[model samples]
Target: MNPDFPILTLLLFLPLVGGVSVVLLWRSPATARVFALLTALAELALGAWLGSAAPAAGPTGYFLYQDLPWIERFGIRYTLGMDGISLVLVLLTAFITVIAMLLSWQEIKERVPLYFALLLATETGILGVFLSLDLFLFYLFWEAMLIPMFFLIGIWGNGRKLYSAVKFFLYTFIGSLLMLVAIIALYLMHGAQTGSYSFALAELVHTQIPYTTGLWLFAAFLLALGVKFPLVPLHSWLPDAYCDAPSAGTVVLAGILAKTAAYALIRFTYPLLPDAARAFTPVIYVCAVVGIVYGAWIAFAQKDMKRLVAYSSVSHMGFIALGIAAWSPVALSGAVLQMVNHGITTGALFVLVGMLSERTGDRESLNYGGLWGKVPVLAFFFLFFNMASAGLPGLNNFVGEFLVLVGTFRVAPGAALGAFLGIVLTLVYTVRLVQDILFGTPSQPMSVSDLSLRESATLASLAVIGVYLGVHPAPVLDLIKVPIALLTKA
Candidate 1:
């Protein structure tokens, strides 16, 4: 809320205003596309600057930290800032927003302006969540962002758009409603104890609640976040939703929504309610390991290409959960890094599926064979992403999963061991997928199209990112250590 540059307000409002502009440009595709890309790119540049400029050690967590009174009586204020962990996620929100827009450039054929407008709105909401130091503001951003996604899936999504959109809405809303109740309870509890009310995260961290109350609060928050992780049984909606949604929409869902949830659990859930998290670790890890194994089992059974990838994400996110449950510092670091790994790798999978569908008119394994021979370039790109998903050596995912497993073995060996078995199952399904889709003989003699220039460029960018992170992750690790060390005190 600092007036100097109004950095936080600028970040939040830019997307809101850009979204409005895109809606106004609804009739012109060319104008809409250009405007949308410009908005996304600008946001990305700003986020990058913010990431680098923020101090390693500062009061509210970053150099840009500041506050302004909103409702003085309630101890509310427009408090916004980032630590290492939050900074990375903010940058991710910006990065994915830009990449998602580019991916949609050629894919979306209608409602261009509305689509991009919603996209920017969604980014704003996500960035708000990452930047806000006030708990109420965080909650507000958390709830507000889902509006655009409901439209993105309903209007631009495929198959049962209404069914999927409504399902996503109801599930998220119920959990968020519970979260709202918890927030109110927190305010009351803080007010009662301190003779003052505050929703600032910094202040709330000091408010001690009984074990029972803390457990209840954690449950409320987890319900909202866990469903988004789409873990195991709660994950039934994902395959259908991702499989049927538009390519860009699927990418955003897989890349951002799930990551947002993972980030939330790490940033807000465990830190705010450490005792509850510890008490609940046994149950949480069981569910996480179950998700890992069960998702792999389902993926192995799926004949739909996109469905396979979707389920794989559930499996990968389960690894994140396990690392979190372990609560070892190293494991937590790996968990943070793995969140990004899942986002990039799975996002790439959806893109490949989209490209394949566009080319050969087949999105299911039952409908494809000898695709590598038909579209070598497409096959090459698809193979790389698949490997990244599988955690092949020298890839982005390998590092995170390895660290998670190693770190967790020291704290929660039982859960980590079970999760390791799940990892083996992961390879089984991923390898089979590659063998079936890329190496098998073609059923039809029809020609398959190669990747377009833009598509290739997009993928190339992703490849470079994977390699860069794989070879040298120290910078990310350095930044992540600060927040994790701080959160440990909670």
Candidate 2:
């Protein structure tokens, strides 16, 4: 909380250090688990503290700014900063990391230490992505996070684990390479125009780019981030990766990893190439609306719970994309809020799905029936999160989606109408899933034992957050108001 303290650096390194420690204590899985949880808890505490401290935004609209020279010749620096947008995501990343560790505690048995280590390492990479102010540093973190995630899916995953891991890697890596090219192009162009080469975001945002060249650069950036956002046609890898990875891995993927792409779109692409961004709005709106409807429609036909949830993410993310594409202050605020809401609600759904799988060794909706009679507690949590995901009136997701629709309607009624259909489809699938899993007669004998204390506590914490955010989104809206205004005005 100290004004002069390097809190961001500590936050950035804490997980890396913990990961290393976890690796060192590989011989003792128990010790490693305990250590890893403590590290995640510590990081979450730091994030909360930073949020409460509420540092003032600097001239560049960043707070807790830290800049140190790194590869000065290229004008790359170990630069990190936070803003209202970054703060919420930092908190989401920290909170989700802890949730992931908890979810994996029992699920990941073999190579336990390595699993926790990878989770923490991914956390550091994601935090770096959120915090880095230099494009080069951001890309470094961007690529670094993929390795552990690849391993997470490849090693501890189920069904088509290797295939899914490879697909996830290739999709993200190829996109990243394109983005790398774009970053270098932007750097060179800025240097050519201003006689100074820099990958500093603050510097590049002021670059004078030709419209044609900007379009290409923006497309490159969009291709890279869209893959991660898994925007419609670019989302092929999501269902596989989400369905195959272990529950903890799936939670991280659905919860926070995808948000990084949305974050990048807002942070880098839109700001660095404003003209290209505006020019691409129509295209983005089309993709967003298509993804919303297509993802929801596909989800309705899914029999597997994991796959359903995975597809639902594609739908929810589409809604977020639509908001961003709308590019209004209200829509952007909603998008930011929905980012957190999706992280909580969808993350909880995935967690509950994992729990159900653990109990029944199955994830099929049809295979599960009358769970309410068998495991009332688990059924309650599952239903609660499903409604949250469905954007029920008083739950967390409704507020975000409502704002997105309202804002998009003002700008593009057609897109808003399309997204509204996705919402209706969302409710349809949600109700079907609820009825199939919770209300029907048992199709087969399954484990009737309910949630453990730890599982209950985990779901309880997320549920409480969803309720609070749903009822009191004013605080989060206030937090993001200035940043969204800056972004929309820009």
Candidate 3:
């Protein structure tokens, strides 16, 4: 860890700084997008550099760490660091932010400046969440992201935007409040035991927690994450939010926001309260399996393209949960890598869906067919991403899901079998989606332009990433192995 250099701090706050500059260009949306893209690209470059500089996997908790005192009285410090897990997520966030900026370039007409600014703000918050090692700091970043996201959905979204925004906000906010309570309780508990106050995660992890207390804290944390993960019954807000939010907003919501829950369970919940995590593992595993099957079944039945993808996210995230429940190095590593895979594959899917909607002026899958005849390039990319999402071999999703199933089978064969069935169910919906949109007889005769150069470039970038990860996922798997090992240690 290099305390001498504040690179992490720059990476964390650079988007916010850029966002303020973008707001100054309120009158010029084109210029705003150019500046925003440059800012996002710069952040991506910085993340790449940081990942390159990261130390090899080892017994140490993290390297490339930064720590500073922010509040003296309460023993809260501005601490940040990254191991293999954090680096991959950081890079994923940076990469996705760039795609999101590109996605909103022409789609967002009203409040253009505000829209780009919110995207940048969301990046800052997500980066802070991934990098912050201080509990207080993490929570601040966690909740700080809501404002921008709320406005993004409410102002720039589709029908029932405001309702979806409020639902999204309330669901997450309620969970965050419970999380706050848990953080404070843990803080006080650590202070009482150590004769000093601190919100440092390193310090808190060492705090001895009673079984009853740990269970309650775990429940609080799990509830908070479950809402964010939108697992099963708590998922009603998710499809509404995804369907109503703009495509760019959907990218962030489905890509990183939900992944945070899986990351949190591995990073904080498991290590901080090992016993509680183990105790509740079976229950959570059941929820994950149910989500897998339920989300797939529901998605298979959806007629709307956007809503179908939204429900598919619920199904994909269920796999992440199943991987976590397995709790083996292979399973955990797969979960971490799957988070990145989901972001890329689904982000591309949403982008393509957005393009289709933009061209046709509708999101209903039933309204269109034989798109391949009109827009071959778009059809090709759509098929490519669909293959990636459906976990075809040699693609990124396959590697993660395969490892997850293999790991789970070793520990819980029944759960693994259920997940496999979910995968099969996913094939049913995803294939049907492709056929309905691209292969069937024309539902409505129409001429549509193919993907523009800019759109092609954007999808091409994501497609390249998907292929590289699919063929050579070793880099990501290698990067995350140490962190998974550290977290799953007895």
> TM-score for each prediction?
0.96, 0.99, 0.98
- Pairs of residues at least 3 apart in sequence or in different chains that clash in candidate 1: none
In lDDT terms, how accurate is model 2? 0.93
Candidate 2 wrongly placed segments (more than 4 Å): none
429 in model 2: Cα distance from truth in Å?
0.7
Tens-digit lDDT string for candidate 3 (1-490): 4748788889999999999999975459888888888999999999998778766645666877888889989989999888889899989998999999888878888778778989999999988888888989999999998889999999999999999999999999998899899999999999999998898988999999999999999999999989998778789899999999999999999988787777878877788888899899898889989999999999999988898999899999989999998899988888888999999998899998888887778888878788888789999999999999999998889999998999999999999999999999999998999998888776677667898899999999999989998999999887887777777775
Candidate order by decreasing TM-score:
2, 3, 1
The candidate, 2 or 3, that scores higher on TM-score is 2
Question: What are the per-residue Cα lDDT tens digits for candidate 1 across 1-490?
Answer: 2338778678767888888988875569888888888888888788787767654576434656668999887788998876788777777777777778878887788878888888899888888887788888888888888899889989988889889888888887787888888778888898999998999877777778899999999888887788888766677778767877778878888887777778777777787788898998888888899999988888899988888888888899998998888877889899999888887888888888887777767776755778787778888988898888888888899999998999989987888889988889989998888888888755665567788898898888888888777888788888888678766644
Order of candidate numbers by lDDT, starting with the best: 2, 3, 1
Model 1: which ten-residue window has the lowest total lDDT? 54-63
State the lDDT at 267 in candidate 1.
Answer: 73
lDDT of each: 0.82, 0.93, 0.89
Query: Residue 84 CA error for candidate 2 (Å)?
Result: 0.9
Number of the top TM-score candidate? 2
